[model samples]
Target: MTALHPPGARERHALVVRGGWDGHQPVETTDAFIPFLEDHGFDVRVEESTAVYADERVMGGIDLIVQVNTMSTIEDEEFAGLQRAVLNGTGMGGWHGGIADSYRNNADYLHMIGGQFAHHASKPPEERTGGQSDNYIPYTVHITELGTTHPITAGVDDFELVTEQYWVLSDEYNDVLATTTQEARPFDAWNRPVTAPAIWIRQWGKGRIFVSAPGHRLEVVQNPSVRTIIERGLLWAAR
Candidate 1:
């Protein structure tokens, strides 16, 4: 991994807030990258709750925020502090349900992130075995023309994955980097094929935000291309 800041530059601070659903393996997944952050010259601080977001002292000095809480609720004051921090130039980044599927009831949070996880289409009943694997389908992440030049995705090619292909709800404000298509098979209800953003970046106020829809687990996060994008994204999003 390359160091982000030049020698002699002020040290950067990174706050990793991870908790909520364990199915996504928040702790393990976030742990996989903490060293990378530290290696890139960040002073890393780890927190297990969103409560830290409400602390102005902590949020005020944070250069980046890596959130991994999924399907969890956020307090009004906590979210307000997070909003203020990001708007004031603290960057944020995360993957899969950690960021996109978090705070399901907070529309403003979704607005700031620029996307939400709608659903992951599952296999037909006849083909299904049991559990979450029913939703795991092989799909290709296609890099866009713009992605060919974007700092986070340049040089990365389309790649295939046999995992949960996320069907996301996103806005035009996002700078889409890569996408995955959910096919309309005979067993599926959707009429036409839909392509959702697989990876993207957004600028909210003075802060930069990066999100990748592919990291459903540690193994997925460790995938070569996915890992490369995320590593680059973390640095790119930092203030």
Candidate 2:
């Protein structure tokens, strides 16, 4: 008979957590990923405090962070710890406008990710951010050839989805994975040739980043294609 080795003492991960915006169900969204990491050899510890940004003690010893909160302020020390954690090889990943559009009051975080949520261009000049838009708009995402050759998306092909077609003002540093274009509707103007990045990956110091623009609802989080992208992204980002 062959003997199996027991798990090691060092097989653990540190997670710094904080987020709000009930629209995204920040708590559930963050928790959804815990099982996946734990199953993949990571001992996950979650800081459930929404004030994790102020708790100096909670920052060190964590291996990665999954942020799901939207629209909050962050202090310098908290930002520093996260910065150090990633620079030391920890990984970070998040989706939708939550993580990417988080901390409306902090400029540093926006600079770290390389973009901010500009005005949602999904609407017309009348209400701008307030009007209702259609769902199941039926969008097609084009997978960049470079993305198909990359680890997180390698072997993945073009797929279609029904969700918010996020039109983002992107940072130049990101390695874009997929993009979708929209035709101008009477309610909005997509007449230009600009493409919206559906998924992207980036780096911050030694840390890694994966961002997805499609998780506008719980159903999207459960979609097979979205799940595949997220699972692969988490592993690829983790050290």
Global lDDT scores for all candidate models: 0.94, 0.70
TM-score of each: 0.97, 0.84
Estimate the TM-score for candidate 1: 0.97
lDDT, candidate 2, 180-211, per-residue tens: 77677666554555676788888988889878
Candidate 2: pairs in clash: 14-62, 14-63, 19-69
- How would you encode candidate 1's per-residue C-alpha lDDT over 1-239 as one tens digit per residue? 67766788888999999998999999999999999998889999999999999999999999999999999999999999999999999999999999999998888999999999998989888889888789888999999999999999999999999889999999899999999999999878889999999999999999999999999999999999999999999999999
Q: Give the per-residue Cα lDDT of candidate 1 at 28.
A: 99
Per-candidate count of clashing residue pairs (backbone under 3 Å): 0, 3
Model 2 TM-score is 0.84
